[model samples]
Target: MNTSSKQDERIARMTFASVYPHYLAKIEKKGRTEAELHQVIEWLTGFDAPKLQQLIEDKVTFESFFREAIINKNVHLITGVICGYRVEEITNPLTQQVRYLDKLVDELAKGKKMEKILRSSL
Candidate 1:
C-alpha cells in the first residue's frame, strides 16, 4: 500500500479511548463543556452517554467504533476542511467519517453555535 493508505490504516487501528482524551482536552481548553462535546459526538455517531462510556472502557479501535455506530443520516451535511482535507471531498469513507467528527469538534472549539455545529436545520 502507499504511504497515505498506510497512515489511514494506522488511524483505523487506533483506539478511540486513546483519542478521546485529546478531543476532550481540545474543546475543554476552548471553554467548551464536556457535555457539548458529548452532544456533538452523539449527533454524529448515535452513541449515547452510557454506551460511549462503555465503548471507552472497552478500548475499541476507530474501525470498531464506527463499524458499530449508527451513523447519523445527515452526516452528508458535515462539510468543510479538517486536517488540511476538505471533509466533503474525501473519498475514503472511514477517513471522511473521522474528519466529520474532527470538523464538529473544531467548530465547537471555534465558538460556533451548537445548533449550527450540529447542522440541526439540515
Candidate 2:
C-alpha cells in the first residue's frame, strides 16, 4: 500500500485496539457469545474502524460523528478495542414528547391571555 494507506491502516489498528473491549462488554451484557462478538468485530474492522479513525484524527466532533456514523446509515458496525454494532433504529421519543409539551405551553399561554383580556373587560 501507499504511505497514506499505510498510515490509515495504523490508525485503524490503533483505534480498533482501543475500542474492542468496550464493544465486547456491551455485546456480552446482551448475552452474545465471543464468536458472535468476533464476527461483529470483523465486520466493523472491515470498513468502519479505518474511516472512523480518519475522522477522529481529523478532529471530527461527536455530533458530526453520530450524524455520519449512525444517523446517515441504518446499520453501522464500529470496532476498535471498543467494538460493537450500532443500530440506528432507536428513536428519541423524548424529543417528540418535548415538542408536544411546548405546544401545550403555547396553548396555555394563549388561554392566560384570553383570561386577562376578559378580566379587564369585566
Candidate 3:
C-alpha cells in the first residue's frame, strides 16, 4: 500500500478506547485534566461526554469514530503544525481529520487557551 492507504489501514484498526489512557496520561503528565481533553474531543467530533464515553466503552476504531463524527464547521480555521505537518495542508482527508484531533489534544496538553485551541467560540 502507498503511504496514505497504509496509514489508513493502521489507524483504522486502532481503537479509540485503546488510546484513551494514553491521552489521559499525556495530558496529566503535562498537568492538564481529563475533562479538558474530553472537551477538546467533543468540540472536534461533536460527541458529548456521554456519547464519547459510550463509544469508548464499545471500543470503536479511529475509522469508525471519524466516520460517525460530525466534524465541526469551524474546523477549517484550525491551522497549525502537528506531527510536523500543517493541518490544512494534509493531503488525505481522513488523515487530516485524525491529525486535527491529535493536534487539538497536543495543544490542550501544552496549556493553550481553549478559545484558541478550538480556533474560535463557535
Candidate 4:
C-alpha cells in the first residue's frame, strides 16, 4: 500500500485503541448497569478491537473499516469516538437501546439534543 494508506490505517487503529477505554470509563461513571457495561466491553474489546487491528494490519484505510463498521452494525464503535461516550457502554447501554442503523442514525442526528439529555441527567 501507499504511504498515506498505511498512515490512515495506523491512525484508525491508534484512534480506536486510544479512545476505547475512555468510552468505557464514561459508561461506568454514568452508572450504566453492570450487565449493560459488560455487553459493551464484550463488543469493544472482543470483535471491534480485533477487527480494527486486523484492518490496520491489512493496510485498509480508516474510511474503509469505518464504513464497514456501520454496514455491519458496528457503528457504535465510531459513534463512541465522535460523541465522547464510554466505549464500554457503546455495546452495553446504547447498543441495546439502538435496534437498527436508522435508529442509531437518528439518535446521532440529534447530537446536540442527545448531549443535552446526557448532561441534564448528570
Candidate 5:
C-alpha cells in the first residue's frame, strides 16, 4: 500500500481516548474550554457529553468512533487544510472525517466563533 493508505491504517487503529486529552490541552492552552471543545465535537459527530464520555471510557478506536457517529449534514461545509491535506480533497471518507474534527479543533484553538465553527449560519 502507499504512504497515504498506511497513514490511514494507523489513524483507524488509534483510540479516541488517547487523543482526547491532547485536543483538550491544545484548546485549553489557547484559552478555550472543554465545553467549547465538546460543542465542536458534537457539531461534527453528534455525540453528546454522556455519549462522548462513554466512548472515551470504552477506549474506542477512531474507526469505531466514526462508525458509530451521527455525522452532521453540513459536514460538506467543513473545508480546509488540516495535517497538510485538504479535508474536502481526501478520497478516504474515514480520513476526511478525522480531518474534519482536526480542522474544527484547530479553528477552536484559533479562536473562531462557535456559530461559524459549527456552521450554524450556513
Candidate 6:
C-alpha cells in the first residue's frame, strides 16, 4: 500500500474512543482534569458528556464520529499545527476535523486557558 492509502486506512479504522484514553492520560499527567478534556471535546464536536460516552461505547471510527458531528460554530478559530500538520491546511475534510480535535486536546494539555480553547463565551 502507498503512504496516502495507509494514512486513509489508519484514520478510517481508528476509533475516537480508542484514542480517548490516550488523550485523557496525556492531559491528566499534566495536572489537567478529565472534565476539562471533555469540555474541549464538547466545545469542538458539540457532543455532551453522555453523548460522548455513547460514541465510545459504540466504538465509532474517527471518520464516522466526525461525519456525524455537529461541529461547533467557533471551530474555525481552532487553527494550528497538530501532529506536525496544519489543521486548516489539511486537504481532506475528515482528516481536518480529526486534527481539529487533536489540536484542541494538545492546547488543553499545554495549559491553554479554556476560554481560548473554546474560542467563544464558554
Judged by whole-model lDDT over C-alpha atoms, candidate 6 comes out at: 0.85
Q: Rate the local accuracy (lDDT) of all candidates.
A: 0.89, 0.34, 0.86, 0.39, 0.93, 0.85
Runs off by more than 4 Å, candidate 5: 1-3
lDDT of 1 by residue, 1-108 (tens): 122787788889999999999999999999999899999999999999999999999999999999999899889998887888888887777877888899999999
Candidate 6 ranges beyond 4 A from true positions? 1-3
Ranking by lDDT: 5, 1, 3, 6, 4, 2
> Which of the two, 2 or 5, has more lDDT?
5
lDDT per residue as tens, model 5, 90-116: 988888888899999999999999999
RMSD of 5: 1.8
Report the number of the highest-lDDT candidate: 5
RMSDs, each prediction?
A: 2.1, 21.0, 2.3, 11.9, 1.8, 2.8
Q: Please identify which of the two predictions, 3 or 5, would achieve the higher lDDT against the true structure.
A: 5
Is candidate 1 or 4 superior in TM-score? 1
- Residue range 1-122, candidate 4, lDDT tens digits: 12244433444444334443444465556554434433343333333555655654666433443445534344333333223333334443323222222233333334334433222233
Collision pairs in model 1: none
- Candidate topping TM-score: 5
**How far out, in Å, is residue 60 in model 1?**
0.4
Q: State how far residue 62 of model 6 sits from its true place (Å).
A: 0.7
Q: Model 6 misses residue 109 by how many Å?
A: 0.5
Model 2, span 53-90: residue lDDT tens: 57647664333333353221212221111112111221
Provide the global lDDT of candidate 3 against the true structure: 0.86
Native-referenced Cα lDDT, model 4: 0.39
Native-structure RMSD, model 2: 21.0
